[model samples]
Target chain A: MASVVPRKSHNLRYKTLMAWLFTLPGLVVQLVFGWLPVLFAFVVAFQRYYFIKDPEYVGVNNFKEVVADPLVITAFQNTLWFAFLSVGLTFLMPIFVSILLMEMSRRTIRVMMILWFIPVASTAGIAIWKYMYHPNLGLLNGILRGLHLPEQKWLDDPVLAMFSLILPGIILFGPGLIYIAALQNVPEELYEAAELEGASFWRKIWNITLPRLRPIIAMMLLFSVIGSMQVFELPFIMTGGGPGYATTTVVMYIYSLAFGAYNLGKATALAIVLFCAIMIMVGFQRRYFPENIDESSENARS
Target chain B: MPLIPQVGRRRPKTRLMLLAIAIFLWIGVLLHLFPVAWMISASFKPTLEIFNAPFRLIPKEPSAASYKLLASTVNANGQSLNVDVFRYPLHIYLQNSIKISFLTLLCQLPITAMAAYAVSKLHSRRAAKWLFYFFMGTLMIPGQIAIVPRFLLLSHFPWPTRTVPGIPFTDLFFPSWSFIGTYWGIVLPAAFSAFNFLLFKGFFDTLPTELIEAARIDGASELTTLRAIMLPLARPVIAVTGYFTFTGAWNDFLGPWIILMSEQQKWPLSVALYKLQWALTSWQPSQGAMDPALQTLISSGVGYNALMALAVVESIPIFIAFLIFREQLMKGIQIAGLKG
Candidate 1:
């Protein structure tokens, strides 16, 4: 037994060494680019960073400023509003559409899902939608004219710009594919048994599918919050955070602070705040709706 | 009664109803595709026809002139709306984009695959789990948080293959291969995709253990076992990853915008398009009398056409790649389930 123990210990040591070696590159990268920057940003949030010079420490002053500043306060309010509304819309639209898509055969369902999934990948779809929302030459304006309805400036109107952003926000909900896959996995026998017991279609869906999908839906809701919160490119191209800051996301604001104003300190401060908000949101999600969803486990095989 | 009727009266009625739903779905799909159709139409029409009220679905006349002009036009005003001589040629930016995307694919795939294999094939579960947790935790850190630091890190670079006298090659090799305003900028930032690593690792994890055992028993090294046994099995995942990396690097505007700031000579197509945003408004009144605003409007159409044309051109390769890899892409996405 002692002899066996030594051999086992030796092998375990060797394997551990190899494992560390294998993991070193990713760990180093995560530390340098992914982890350290976050820590640095956090530190800088309390300090001040000036371009072409060293940072000077200032204890909690930046946070005080961030909280007290009217712009920051407004940004926080606007961000929360956008997040809640977009997250609600993105989450619900997919489940609703998936149910509608579910009323067809598996073949048709697959085609529709693919069509929906394509936009999640291709920026072309977003570009196309931007052109469609153009105030003068865009299709939406054309349609409004044809119908003799009011033509909106769309992205150019402060009141309407955020709403304009919402159109793509609604059209581009891709949670449907994941939802469909999850829906398909619910054992048919359960549904058949429900039907045999005289449960109506709506009742079967409510009881069987919704309960089964709680974990996935929870994760999707988290995804929607994180995604809409950090969104930059869409508004960057479509509105440039105008008509007058209505569409400026927190990320865009940070980018402008960092590059445009060259105020790395304020940018880092904003970034840390954004990061904390995300962490808090994620923490809330994990607390409220925890899952043993090894989401990546499904990534290995189709 | 038959448990599952195959073409009885009730089944047919149900099938007919489903078919009706399917046809209705086709209409919904068409409505979804409406914007894309409109974009194509706008790209083809002349300036006068584009803004004509009650915008015509069918153009009065369509022309390929916009596409042709964009493809060939070298010197055009960039994104600035109020500046002349602020323009750079699209071809240079396009070339830069293509160069960077290709290299990004080249560097990212092998590095990620090697790292993935290492993670999956490692003998210790504790180490593997830690690596995974570390990688996955990166997902929660909003990338915006890292942007400032990363930009700072990139600025202190001495790029494109330099040598230091004493040290091992990698450190010196690295700063020389620095990631600011160059192709390496795009490639390096993107190289460590934790999600891709997970995808690759997941695929490697599912491989038959016996094959690795046999290879090791035959005295093959760990790297050799990976090369011989694991890689061939992971071709589908790798191909999908490659396609994904290509598309992402091709379309990304943020990295370039942050890191590459020397305008005119140093920009990608996306940056060029962004710079060209107000290029139309900057047109000077041809040193003669005419409503310069009217002239500006006409020129603005040309610029607008150019921008849309760029969007179309950028999208074609991706759309074609989609058609080619439809099955694989679908299969890959279904598995990966989108981490970002």
Candidate 2:
């Protein structure tokens, strides 16, 4: 006696159709909000125009003007310098702090990690470092006075102003958390193996820990560079782009042009240029540092 | 399995030093909290007591006078219009912020999550891989370049509601460039973020493949499977993204500053706080009957207090949510970081 068997062939065609349908929303968003506008920004860079008026094709004048203007030149140079110094400081501080944090017992490390993360969660604009920089009544100045040293107008002098802007953010670094996370992810066997080989704490860090952390170090460097280049609110609030444009950043420049002066075309042009510059530099960095330098050759020298 | 365990006891001195370091970290935390505490303490003080001879860590006489000022009314059109003459009515702004944030989240999160899932989980292996690459590639494009065109598009939007041809209500709705100071202007641009989509995709990829296979064998439709199974499973990641989105909207100042006129009544608290100082210092508060020194100090202190209050109020929701979902939030963050 033969039984009537059920025929069931799962059709994946329905899944394919459903998948496309599901992706439609994101496609629309990226098309409208991302790609289209970015394309227009590139087009705007080749033209000289304002928001209300028609754009006139000026092929490279905007770039030439950007390069020729002394202020723009200074901004570019200052941006690079700021990026280098700030990224170095941020990248190095975290690695050192993370190593220190790793040396702690598990219970203590959790507490330290939690404390390190609180400031990162808080609003960047609300921190009152500018107020604390007040010459007469400020905390820093008060300390200087206590030591019988003359007070300085922290926000007034051009040479010291940019450093002042960076000073407040130094203590606000959240790299400790990232470094801790990276350190925790390292395999315990490697440490045990190193210990069996008579590796000291510092030697373990140099030989294994730092090498393992190289990728994260690279990531932190890239982010710090981008972040410092885009610094806006802190300096904007503190100095208002002054003691005479000493600390005016690329983003601040675009802001003043577009919103302050109503030159949307030029602003868009500048923005596109900055974006390209960042991409090229970052691409170069990634290409040059393809394999992270994680070898253990220099363990004894340091 | 235990991830780590003692291979023998550590030395006592190393243990003591670690304890000391932990204490130092707590002290560092106290330092970080100092400004925030000052901001809170300043908000409770009366206007006259702001620059009191010595700084008040704990307010000598705490009052809700500032918050009251933010909610009080001024006479207009022969009646009170609930205008805040000194401080902006932050409570109203807070409501608008909540409405926009929730609307944006409700509309965007499921849609983006679905898209991300489709790209990552619901396709032939090759198709999914290529789609993932394309989506990730978009992250290379910075947001600044898109500002001008986006603004132009928003400003020149055709009217949503229209009238019948040759009717009395011909002007009911015409092509209009009048969204500058409206809620839609803020919501439309901010609703779809790539970062959230990528985050969700990362979460979805880590999920076991067996669940999908089980549902498929059960003859559940793809959409049904997504709705009934995937969405519920993605809760922790969704929650983190939702909180971040809400806070981003609440704290966004640049968008409003660009689109809104100074006197627009519907601006968010961030914009209101910024404009508050600009309005006061426009003609220099020290120019008139007030003594220059006192006027400057008072104006600065007032501005500072308003900013502090706004920041604290805006941050409370995110902090509470984070505390509630602490464990899952950390896990979600780790997933996102690894993918990044």
Identify the leading candidate in terms of lDDT: 1
Error of 2 at A197 (Å): 1.7
State in Å the error of residue B48, model 2.
Answer: 3.8
Candidate 1, B109-142: lDDT as tens digits: 7767776777777746776677778777888667
Query: What are the models' TM-scores?
Result: 0.85, 0.85
**i-RMSD values for every candidate model:** 4.8, 4.1
RMSD per candidate (Å) reads: 6.3, 5.3
What class would a CAPRI assessor give candidate 1's docking? acceptable
Pairs of colliding residues, candidate 2? none
Q: Which residue runs of candidate 1 sit more than 4 Å off their true CA positions? A: A1-22, A99-103, A117-126, A172-175, A292-302, B1-20, B74-88, B157-178, B263-266, B278-297, B300-303, B337-340
Clashing pairs for model 1 are B74-B89, B78-B275, B78-B276, B79-B275, B79-B276, B79-B277, B81-B278
For residues A9-79, what per-residue lDDT tens digits would candidate 1 score against the true structure?
87667656765666666566666666766666766676677675667888877777666767676566667
